[model samples]
Target: MNNSAQKPGLRERKRRETLQRITDTGLKLFLSQGYEETTLDAIAEASGISRRTFFYYFKSKEEILLAWQSGTGAAIAAAIQEQTADKAPIDAVLDAILSLASQFDANELVAIERLLRSTEELRASKHAKYVQQEGAVFEALCAKWPQARRRDSLRLIAMASMGALRLAVDRWVEEGTKRPLAKHLRETFESLKAELGRQS
Candidate 1:
């Protein structure tokens, strides 16, 4: 009912459409010409946008591949941070991962995985993003587990849990995500905790 409200909504829609066009066009060119061979100029031209506009959307060619992979871990990190004091660490970790994985579209995740594997740079970028995300999760977990008898035990748990997440992602992609990623992650983390708990 408000003209000004509708104007912002229209602009947001236009921005999404433009970004999608750039993403789609850039991805297509990367595949066709090869990831290392693709150029921003070609991508911008194909997307019917100026080079400057493409730069505004993506800082570099590798950024397009990194974009989808970067922000994904934030949800899991935040979920872990918000766990109640009474929640078991294992349950909190699994539930955080499960919450994030459930929000991803499996099919699209598969495509992002494919693109991520295309170059060492892209894979490294993905790893770097997850590393920062893991650091954040670990800090949040340390604060939550204040009564931990040994600080090293909490650190080990954080390291091992994040490692399990990486393995789950690998399995999820290799299996083409036929099953829910949340299930894969939960089972993997549960198994890791059980195995490690026995050793501790």
Candidate 2:
């Protein structure tokens, strides 16, 4: 078997490299200069691509920010799929989210998040990102536990889980703590569970 046949061809590899370069250059400019202030020409120039070439990779500058959010959402979904079947669905989702949080460089996330909230347009995009992420989590859970009866419960858990994560990240960013994001996630989950328990 020619396993080498499965490898990406030169064109595909080059495409991926160019895409990465654009994303990296765009993000750097977005973070260093404010998102609205950074122009497309600046990103294209920094990436060594033509302005028209930038449109081939992304429809708009906002798409670049969403691209970063999309990657995080996919990572959460991937982590959810990796959870063992025996664990409670909520716990599995929590662990997956915690794992994702643990991987982030706290300072980098703080900067990115601040940028996301810097303008009205970006704030709307940030909210949309959360909605998309919640959908991703729900879809991943439904895949993991295929029982029809569990659909509604899984949806609820996904919503609650994302809520916990949002609260955790907000507090973590507000405090600008050296403490790890995972710790904030754990505490947020604990508080959520405790509050729910009180209601029950």
Candidate 3:
């Protein structure tokens, strides 16, 4: 409903920065004290923002955990929408995902993986945020495809593409940064394509 849900400097870069601060602080506390042990007041205090200010950026502690993925997921959705209409939907989606991975620091990602595995709540939060992220990407793809092509086929492909990206990240973290993350993402996307083809 609110276009504020859309991102980047259309307005309030300050807001995004504040959200990041809250997210970083919240994540650190979650990792250190355990998610269930951490309180919102502690997070707000750690972020150096008032409790009211914290609520202005996010509704609850869960929203703080979702914040990091939300920002990156928005960017990935925008990238997919930027692709030319000539490309196939799968190519457009996976290429956008790969490009995003190119900008990522593999070491930093591994650190996040460690953080996510730190608590049961964090692990569950990771999966929940991913579902939200996929919904965002799927909506972007829905906007880009031709009306005639925007059927079950497109939705299925979008779901599968998100699944491929998730698997790519899983393998990337598990592999201990032996190779570039972008390469791993691309490879996973290709593997997904082949598997889908086989089922077709």
Candidate 4:
């Protein structure tokens, strides 16, 4: 089948567009005004949707904030898949994560992280997001190296990779470093490798 035949229909496209608009509007308001200060009614108005319509796309403002994080897992998964098969699994995952981190604008990331940290609920919920990312990375690794015996090792790599990423982000944010996030990610991955006695 052709790509067009596989693509979403017009109605689906419209729904996606509307959903993105709402997410973008909410993120803008949250970043500029403050997450606690932004209201559901304000997001609905800014997105050109009724409050009821907003509910059709998301149940709450927290969900909208989650939406701002939507594509990252898939991007990481894709990056892992794109790595040359000759590379070791750990190296591939490290490259994938670094690529993703490099794409993020440091200032915007700081703003978004601040907004997320502003709410106790968001901070708690964010762990679930990391878990989801680990799953994505694990699946991608398995697809690339499908030996059944490797499954356990792949799972560990996924978990450890995500743990390192979280540590890097936390330190980067706390220090307010002007350095690029990719640098932090690389350093974290190096520490991870060293802790494992340089075993890939």
Tell me the TM-score of each prediction against the true structure.
0.71, 0.88, 0.79, 0.93
Residue pairs clashing in model 1 are none
Flag regions of model 1 displaced more than 4 Å: 1-39, 42-49, 56-58, 146-151
**lDDT per prediction?**
0.77, 0.89, 0.82, 0.88
Candidate 1's TM-score reads 0.71
Candidate 3 lDDT for residue 154: 79
Candidate 2 at residue 35, lDDT? 82
Instruction: Name model 3 segments beyond 4 Å from true.
Output: 1-17, 24-43, 59-62
Global fold similarity of model 4 (TM-score):
0.93
Deviation (Å) of 149 in candidate 4:
1.3
Cα lDDT tens digits for candidate 1, 59-164: 9988876654545556666788777868767678778878777776677667767778877777788888777767766776787887667467666667777889
Across 1-200, the per-residue lDDT of candidate 2 in tens digits comes to: 89779999999999989987888889889888878899999999999999999999999998888888988888999999999999987788889988877777777789889988887988998898999999999999999999999999899889998999999889888888667788888899888888877988
Q: Is candidate 1 or candidate 2 better by TM-score?
A: 2
Q: Count the backbone clashes (under 3 Å) in each candidate.
A: 0, 0, 0, 0
- Candidate 3: tens digits of C-alpha lDDT, residues 1-200: 87767756634787777878889898778767866798999999999999999888888887776677787789989999989889988999988887787786666667767777777877898888788787888788888985865767877877888888888878878888788778877898889889888998
Worst 10 residues of 3 by lDDT: 3-12
Show pairs that collide, candidate 4: none
